[model samples]
Target: MNKILIIGAQGMLGQELLKIFPQAVGWDREEIDITDEKQVKQKIIDFKPTIIINAAAYNAVDACEQAAEFELAKKINGCALGYLADVCLTLNATLVHYSTNYVFAGDKKDGYQESEPPNPVNKYGQSKLLGEREILRRSNLKYYLIRTSKLFGAKGKSTMAKENFFAKMLILSTKQIELRVVDDELSNFTYAPDLAQATNILWQESHASGIYHLVNANPRTWYEGARALFDILGKKVKLIPVAADEFSRPAKRPKYGTLLNTKFPKLRDYEEALEEYLKDRN
Candidate 1:
């Protein structure tokens, strides 16, 4: 049996990974801090896993604008990855790291492909991009750099309590009669369970090790996603579509962060995944 170690095992995607790979060893932030090089080094040497999946990331987009926060983000998202990659290389373990679609400028109308060069528009994206570069530049180990977008899971009951966008919209629908959502930004919405399934398939079946765009098929705006949630739940609410500029935040989002999967089989549609998530929620 292959020994698998999952960092950030308590996070949204991390939780799903734990469920999927129940035998895999899990470490949350409390158990191991990736930012601390000493701690990370010690843990990896102790576990000596055949596969190391880094599910941890500092993903606060707007908060990353601050000088201090940006530095921390880089340390966690960028520099920490270098440490993991180096250790994996030494241990001869395959490293699996998650990235975001934010790496693109979103200028492409059709959506970004895995081969497209990354042009991050904000501090968060830049940090993630740095991590990707670190892995390729430093590590000789076989690695998978998976880029996804708009993740939602059933781990938490509410969006405020959980980090998922779909749960947040569902929570808002119950309280607010009307909601304003950004329509200008376009991206694929991914369901965590479906993503987990695809990831496992890639790990087991695919021999090629490189960047893969793993996300639900069909691009849609945030507004459209919210509308679909209401329609699926048989809830009627006034959803107003607004441009990305309408909401002012510290970080800039890609206008078209949708990702195209040219490597593996396309995952299920966003609607199909969302419906399954909502059904499970109920």
Candidate 2:
């Protein structure tokens, strides 16, 4: 039997991964500090897992622009992977990690493919790219680097969890009759459950270790996504589409960061996934 271990088990995607791989041992930051090399090695060595899935990430994109937060993000999203990969290489464990679409420069209007080179526009993206290089640079390392975007589903149980875009829109709907959302930036909206299932498929099929883009089919702007959410909920909130510059953000976001899934069979469309999410949430 292949023993599997899931780090960041309490996270949004991690929670869904646990359901997909029920036999896998799950660990949150409380169990093992991935940033601590000694602790990370000891924990994985003790578990002796054949596969290691890392779902933890420093996801505060805007905050990463600050020097202090950038360092923390780099440590968690970048250096922490080095720690995990060191152990995976030592144990010959297949390492599965998630990355963001933000790694791309976002100039391509058509969206990004798995083969495209990454040029991050922000500190968060920089940190994630660092982690990707750590895994890829190791020629002997067996790893899966999945790049996804705009994830939504159940909020994570961890304190570090932030409400996803859809959740935030829902809350704003209750408070305000009208809302302004950015329409210029484009990216796919991924459902956490769908992503988890796809990750399991990759592992179960023993797919080759390489970069993969896993996200819902359609690429839409944040404004479009909000419109879809309100439509699905049958809410009457007025949504105004505005340019990205209207709101001041600490981190500079790419105009287009959609992760085009050209590797595995395409997952269901975002609208379908969003509907399922609404049902599940209710």
lDDT of 1 by residue, 146-219 (tens): 99999988663223235578878877878888999999999999998888778788898855889999999888
Worst 10 residues of 2 by lDDT: 256-265
For each predicted model, how many residue pairs clash, with residues at least 3 apart or on different chains?
A: 0, 0
Best by lDDT: 2
| Candidate 1 pairs with clashing backbones | none
Candidate 2 residues 178-281, lDDT tens each? 99999999999999999999999998898889999999988999999999988988888899999999999988999988887888999999999999999989
lDDT of 1 at 196: 78
CA-lDDT, candidates in order? 0.88, 0.93
- Kindly give the stretch of ten consecutive residues in candidate 1 with the minimal lDDT sum: 154-163
Tell me the TM-score of model 1: 0.96
What local lDDT score does residue 80 receive in model 1, on the 0 to 100 scale? Answer: 95
